[model samples]
Target: MTSFKIPSAPRSIQKDNPIKFLLDSETIDCLAHNIALVHPVFDAQAFKRLALTNIAPLGIMDRSAHIAAALKATLPAKFSEAADILLQTLTPPNVHTDRLGLSVFFYLPHTRFIADYGRDAQHNSGEDPFDVAMRAQYELTRRFTAEFSIRPFLTHDFERTLNQLQQWLNDPDPHVRRLCSEGSRPRLPWGARIPQLIADPSPVLPILEALKNDPSLYVRRSVANHLGDIAKDHSTLAFEVCERWLTDADKDLKWVIRHAVRHPAKQGNATALAIRKAAGGR
Candidate 1:
């Protein structure tokens, strides 16, 4: 079987500005076109105007924030109504097999908007909006990703949110399975740190156990990253997990274990060193 390599972000995007790549005029036009297909009542021109207004002065993060706020303001006032509109507008999952395809970039802002709205509502209402948020995230991830979006739930309601993530372990879609680990990482980049997990990552062991040998490399990579996050604060725990999983492991599983202990291995931690030795320093 031949694998298709997904191209990296354009050099212009990488060197100039990531925000421009995401919210550029071309992306907005694609978004408008797709949205109009699902929503006859949608005002594409108005939506574009709102999203692009004053967007020039902002930096990368601020641009994303501005777009989220703009989405909420222009779309239906009702949360459910607005969420439904966005969900319907999502491009088909099969349309973009490449993880970093243009379609994913186009949908990124919309996913973030859903996440921000859900998080605010959950925080203010003091209610677990896990179901609603998870459902939206599950769908949104198929198009782009909800990794950063799901962090609020994990922060506010760790146990409940974790239980929901555990259920996602069996999801047929590799993205959903990946989310189980990625969304729960203690130190995910560009995401809020989860103090509880950083202090004691034992709660997430079950999740890691389930995905340690995931068929999808995408999912397995997340498991490794989640473990690496754990190692930052709990090196012993990370080392122990790696040691246990290293014995009689295959190449793929060993890759995961190595990634899990990368930080500790660099620092000459005994157990990390031993695990690397066991894997023959591959």
Candidate 2:
């Protein structure tokens, strides 16, 4: 990891500072509040000390709860410029997945810009350390779903996203594969619930189907989670799909079943649970 010098004032923060100026916007305030909440979870002083020394992305994540709101309010006026700024500010040395997770909102309103950045990152030369660029792509998709309702432009990329996900499922890198599922998941924590996938997740079904038996526990966990998201809206359909593969399912599949079925079972939604149980145990 290169030495990251945190920008004096992140560009996103500068461009969208007007929102900050106005009434102390709810989103910005929320980020401030969340940071305070996270302070106790991890010892702030120790974490900052570690950041000064080791300089890991995790350190940024520890502080991101505070940065999210500022990022959210700071959207750039132009797409190209925004992408350039985000890539410069958030990449390498400063590559903090958790923090980026929060700051990701900075790009939420302009997903196309973020997508372009992802494409550039994929082709650009550098260490590509920690697969940070790939993770940004994932976060971009995740936020796209969460912040904005599914629109035509977003749906247009649905197929491509699924294709990329499928390709990554077989990636030699387990983390990349995990990101594939995580990105596509309907209910990935803090990610958007892809209504298109939820209404008819057929696009991603085949991909998850292929990954149900993935070797990596990390990747398999994401597979289970992706299915679990589908199960939320299309319980019968998701259950049926899972059952069809029951005979082929391995230990990982079982775990997926448990994770994917939790909400339905907890809600006492017999219809969904019955299908889940018939497919397999808990």
Candidate 3:
């Protein structure tokens, strides 16, 4: 298998710089406050203490996990009930993709909360936990990404998750549509790896196809990256998919195919290069 390297972010942090900590103490406390408002029984101070304890030493992702753990500790023991509380506490949904600023990061713990506790949660309402999780992701994704939260469902229940993602392909929210592709990426950076998808990407090909001509560049970009991930392990398959798309491709789709083969084109893969050239890439 060929290698594809993703550059890591700078780990050195200026502890005193407030911007360095996106989910710092104040943010965690704010998260607690929001949950407390929706949930009458929640102890906001206890949640704040648990979420903030030793959080100063952690990175942004770790802080998300830490706070999610605190949520597990203090929230209702039943994952379904806790998920409902978190869902109720969400702020307004976002429509545009950029300029949202770091405030969007506030929901990181919310997404993490679903991922950690909702993976196998059982319910009495005859509603599958998958339904709750996907609904939460649909809503959570509107405000902040649920890409990270959607993976466990993908792994825990592949066919069911894929079906739900397909149903969401036409969702009005671009963020929700983006999740259909980005969440299923075989080699999603800084997210859980789907070894099965990594080994055989045929399953997600339909997803890539459905979103190939998406109106939002945000969604199309994820399709390109999803195809790019497929290229890493299945070069011929990736090139073939791009080649098929190029036959009657539009400007937007042409760009997606070009980007899909970018890394392999750099690595001198003949098929990738040919696909790139055909897609009008320099």
Candidate 4:
């Protein structure tokens, strides 16, 4: 297995000037205020107190982890109960909306909590936990993204998770379609690496094929990234997919193929170079 370098940001916080923390005071306040409005029983004051306690010492990722831990401690004990509250409180997605809203980004911590804490319960239950997580992720991505949260299921049950993701390619929501590719990336940034997919990317090819020419550029970009991740480990496979997609390609797909082959092209791989050449690259 190639030991791909993990980004330095996750290892240590920057020294002189700090990166902005996602779960800062204002973001927490916005999150609490929104949760309070939707879930009447939610204890906003208590939640805020728990969330902000000792938060200054933590960096960006740590803050997100801390917020998830706080939600587990403060929210309803039952996984479904807590997840339901989050699902009900999410802001609806709009077609014109390209970026996540403030409240939605803040609420991502809660979604992470559900995905992590609720994993065992959903797996053990008679019902499919991936489905449960997928539903929560679908709603969550509309506002923010469940891309990070959904990786656990992929690790836990690859076949079932990938199957569901394939179905998601046809979803009405572009976010959900994007999740199909983004969540399944072999080397998703800030996400736990899926060694199985990295070793054998055949599983992910179908999902990418389904999303290759998706109407949404958001989904197309994710598909490109997912392919690029594959190229890191399996250049031959990535080039094959790129070659297939490039035959009589439209403008959008040409962009995806070009992005997918970038890493390999950089390495001077002949097939990758040829694909780039066919795409009219200089």
lDDT of every model, 2 decimals: 0.75, 0.49, 0.84, 0.75
Candidate 1 C-alpha lDDT tens digits along 94-124: 4333445453556667767766787555432
Top-down TM-score ranking: 3, 1, 4, 2
TM-score of each: 0.86, 0.51, 0.90, 0.86
What count of clashes does model 3 give?
A: 0
Q: Give each model's clash number.
A: 0, 3, 0, 0
Ordered by lDDT, highest first, the candidates read 3, 4, 1, 2
Q: How close is candidate 4 to the true structure, as a TM-score?
A: 0.86
Best by lDDT: 3
Task: Give me the runs in candidate 2 sitting further than 4 Å from their true place.
Answer: 5-153, 271-282
RMSD (Cα, Å) of model 3 = 7.5
lDDT of 2 by residue, 1-282 (tens): 333222122334455353222222332333323333433232334333332332223222222332332332343333333334444433232222233323444333233334333333233343221234334454444332212212222345565545555666666655455566666676656444567766777777777777777877766777777787787778777777766766756666776776777777789977657656765665
Give me the overall lDDT of model 1: 0.75
| RMSD to the hidden true structure, all candidates | 5.0, 12.5, 7.5, 7.7
Evaluated against the true structure, the overall lDDT of model 2 is: 0.49
Write down the lDDT that model 3 would get.
Answer: 0.84
With candidate 4 superimposed using the best TM-score fit, by how many Å does residue 164's alpha carbon deviate from the native?
A: 1.7
Model 1 deviation from native, Cα RMSD in Å: 5.0
What local lDDT does model 4 show for residue 150? 80
Which portions of model 3 miss their true places by more than 4 Å? 1-20, 122-128
Error of 4 at 32 (Å): 2.4
Residue pairs in steric clash, candidate 1? none
